[model samples]
Target: MFARASEDGFIHDMVLYYGKTTLEAHDVPLKPEQEGLGATSQIVSVLASTMSFPTTTAIFADSFFTSLELVRYLQDHNCRYTGTARDNRIGKPQLGTIKEMEKKAVPRGTCYYVTSDDGILAVRWKDNKTVILLSTDMGEGPMSTVLKYCSESKKREPVGCPAVTRSYKANLGGIDKSHQVLPMKSNRRYLRLFAYVIDVSLTNAWVVYKRDCKALGVKCQPLKDFKL
Candidate 1:
């Protein structure tokens, strides 16, 4: 499977067969009634069960897919992962409450991070919002700047945030955009899946066409025009 983002939206070139193949390779029993698994853990378990990563690889995910347990699991396999997490998730360090932080007036662009004994990096940064991230591969400091909307200035302002956060902001939209544009709604499950596959194929083609056109210094066809 491939994941990417474009004007059309977040797209993943997924094959259902690959999911099944991964499951089979791991000898995962075909049984239900699994309990004591948080929703995030189940998602991570599926990914970890199916895929093996090289030591240099890093996986990035959003809050819904992130947990300290997942990071440790990936680390145990010599892989790295970076992702945002909810404040309420278990196994995370007990940072001060959000309300207390607000009362203390945590400044915009302020960031704090702790490196666990096991070397997991947990960071908290305040922009217009406060976001917490867990990573096995990110440094404890900001190495880049990003443009964010400032309500007081009524304009975009550059603020410094961690490099991992910068990377996440840049690539997080790929899946979201695909969901927005690919309007697949069919009563039959198989038909809906078929349409989704076609949508991904077209999007991937568009990406390749745009890349090749750019490299050749040729005028790129608009997606709408290319669709014709």
Candidate 2:
């Protein structure tokens, strides 16, 4: 399943994975450039179409749903996106190689970034491991500091973190949080998808209820009580 969720864990929309043929049969539109992309990219495109354009909706996702083409597509549609990217999916940007980034001589917080002509930024940063991120709305500058445990010194120390990385880390858990609140139980083989759909419906309704309560200045119950 693929879902578009808010930072506070409100699920806006979702699509069950039914393969490319099903998507085509449903007449889901895809740009010419997006035609041959992987299934994950296609899913992103379909979910994004459900959103209103030019709202500056910031999308945060993991490597499974991020690619250079998808980032470009989001940018063209006036949406902002930041996500971890697989090295191969980022194209041959003039960024450091994994070997160079992992060398002993390199500093732990070292970072390199390059912006494409179309204004997509690809950032490569080193912490305990190398992380490559892509963004349409962030830059390399104005870095933030994050606390990291230093095993050698046995103390926690501050490490420089890129803005894109920081944003992705902050916003990437919406779907996971949504799942935690409305977990689905194991069911008979044919009933599994139906159970998942019911859970998602309940979660979305619960989120909207909480929002309405807050807006109306009314006290809200916990999800368990609200469900009852």
Candidate 3:
């Protein structure tokens, strides 16, 4: 599912598939979670249809949608991912704990990357809090740094961050924007589903329309006007 940050509240390119089947009731080596991970990879494959060679695409997702397995899957497909991950996820790096880092006098905005046996890079950074990110598409060097306010220091300072972190922070807003603009708050489940389909369609169309207008150097039509 694709969502714009805080604007449309619409989920785009959503594909639904049932998990339970007569075959599933019999013999399957993979666990249900593995099946779900495979399904998620397929969704990403569908979303990457427009991508071409040498033009890398990055997927940003929350912890629920990210794992080392998922990172490898995208890497195999020539894509990259940046997402929050739980510490316990399999193959996740044993980065130093927040306490350990604090004890070591690690400064805010400091970032470290650990490469797994499979060559996937896991990034750990200290901000207001410790953040762990899994990535396949980021380089070792920091692309740029940003000034982030540190409460302890009571001042803002330039913090070095990896490219994946920067891109994730920038692009993370699409889903949030979608949620704000077209909130899918319906009591009835069926109505909710119906609203989701409509809202996604409308939001996707609007995004394309706005992009085309920008490319052509024309003013974008208002949402009301575009809907008409």
Q: What digit string (tens of lDDT, one per residue) describes model 1 on residues 1-228?
A: 334233345243232335524334334432342223455554455554445444865667778778877777668778777788888762657565566555546767777777889988887877777888888877856466778898888999888788767766765565676566565689997897788788777766766777789899999967766443
Q: Which candidate number would show the highest TM-score if scored against the true structure?
A: 2
Of models 1 and 2, which has the larger lDDT?
2
Best candidate (score: lDDT): 2
Q: Write the per-residue lDDT of candidate 2 for residues 1-228, one digit (tens) a residue.
A: 678888878887777667656466434567776677677887887788787654568888998889998898878878888999899999999999989999999989999999999999999999999999999877887898999999999999999998878877887898887888776677585577788788888888888898899999999887766533
TM-score for each candidate, following the candidate numbering: 0.71, 0.91, 0.74
Indicate whether candidate 1 or candidate 3 has the larger lDDT: 1
* Candidate 2 C-alpha error for residue 57, in Å: 0.8
Q: Output the worst ten-in-a-row residue range by lDDT, candidate 3.
A: 1-10
At residue 174, candidate 1 shows an lDDT of 55
Ranking of candidates on TM-score, top first: 2, 3, 1
By the TM-score metric, which is better: model 1 or model 3?
3
Error of 3 at 4 (Å): 10
Those runs of model 1 whose alpha carbons end farther than 4 Å from true positions after fitting are 1-37, 48-54, 90-94, 143-145, 180-191, 208-220, 226-228
